[model samples]
Target: MKRQIIASINHNLGRAIALLDVIDSKTYQDTSIGPYYSSIGSHIRHTLDFFDCIISGLDTNDIDLTARKRDEVISTDKDAAKDHIYKIQETLTSYTDVNTDYLIHVTDNMGQGKITVNYTLESILAHANSHAIHHYATIGYMLEQLGVSIKIPGFGYNPTTPVNKREGI
Candidate 1:
């Protein structure tokens, strides 16, 4: 289960890296697309922020979702985003020996007040993966609006989502 979770995350991160390699800095940092006007780099940084929180809190067993770095460089530079992703991948690789069932406390605000809840390490990791995918879908919309074509298959889709529905085919 640990291996599967790590593989899924790494696979998605790889897709992000692939897209970054193809897209120029202008496309990555462009916020001119969509009603929200969020850039692709912003989405990448936001998604990675969740993982960063998890990695930082691992030793303490207390994860704070709101403690994001939101670094400007990460939100505007593809190389910096790639570097952050690589660091996350490296940290995830070291978790191979950790117990997935270990309990941890997670704190996050759900449009209300901040709340803390108990979660297994595996469960939080899985949630983070799903969260990343959700943000990737938004990034996909931004890419389409910017006329950027990415070759990574299932780049922003959940594994259980039908390909036909996702592609409108």
Candidate 2:
């Protein structure tokens, strides 16, 4: 199970690195999209922030979802984003054999106030994977609006998506 979870995280990190190969800094940081006006880099950085929180909290078992680093360089610089992705991939790879059966406390602010919830390491890791994929789909939309071509065919798809659907049936 840990191996599978780690692989899923690595999969998204690989896609993020591949994205840098196709997009330049200007498009990466472009926030001129209409309506919500979110930049691709913003989504990418946000996606990474969740994983960062999990990894940082692993030792202490006190994961705080709202305490994101929100590194500006990662959001605006393609090279910085790539470097960060590589670091995350390395961290996840090291956790494959670690015991994840213990409970982890997760804290988050849901508009009204802060709340804490109990979670197993495995469960939160699963959430982080799902979270990254959700943001990747948003990045997909942002890239499309910016006229960027995706080199990875299933970069943002859910793993449970039917194989035929992913292949366009």
Candidate 3:
């Protein structure tokens, strides 16, 4: 079960990385219409930050994605963000590669109850995917407001994605 979950996360993260390839770094720097620390750039950065946090505990790889709260610029280099995200997924798969029956408990920092680290990993993946969707949706709206059509092909596949399978979640 763990192996299958890891494989799915790899696939989903791959898709997201592909979609991100289409995002102009400039677009990432664009601020959302009305929100704090809610620009496309920071949204991407934050997703990386949060996932890296969980993956650190996984001890597969140390992926630090935290950016200055005041600076919303997507890493001037988008590849770096993509590379880091890629590494996170890779390390996760490697970590789970040998463990088919291991589970570690950790307190849920925000939820109502405690859960296992393995479960936390899945939850974090879901959160990351949700963050991506929010950023993508906001970027879509921002683009439309600017009179530009979304260039990404799969943006229309789901108006809202709750089932983000194959990704880490």
Q: Each candidate's TM vs. the true structure? A: 0.94, 0.92, 0.62
Q: Rank the candidates by lDDT, best first.
A: 1, 2, 3
Residue 54, candidate 2: how far off, in angstroms?
Answer: 0.7
What C-alpha lDDT, on a 0 to 100 scale, does residue 168 get in candidate 1? Answer: 13
RMSD of each: 1.8, 2.0, 6.1
For model 2, residues 30-112, the per-residue Cα lDDT tens digits are 99887788788888899889989999988998999999999988899888888899999999899998877878999989898
Model 2 pairs whose backbones collide:
none
Better of 1 and 3 by lDDT: 1
Q: Candidate 1 regions off by >4 Å?
A: 166-169
Best by TM-score: 1
Model 2 worst lDDT run, 10 consecutive residues: 160-169
Candidate 3: residue 64 lDDT (0-100): 28
Quote the lDDT for 20 in model 2: 81
Clashing pairs in 3: 8-166, 9-167, 9-168
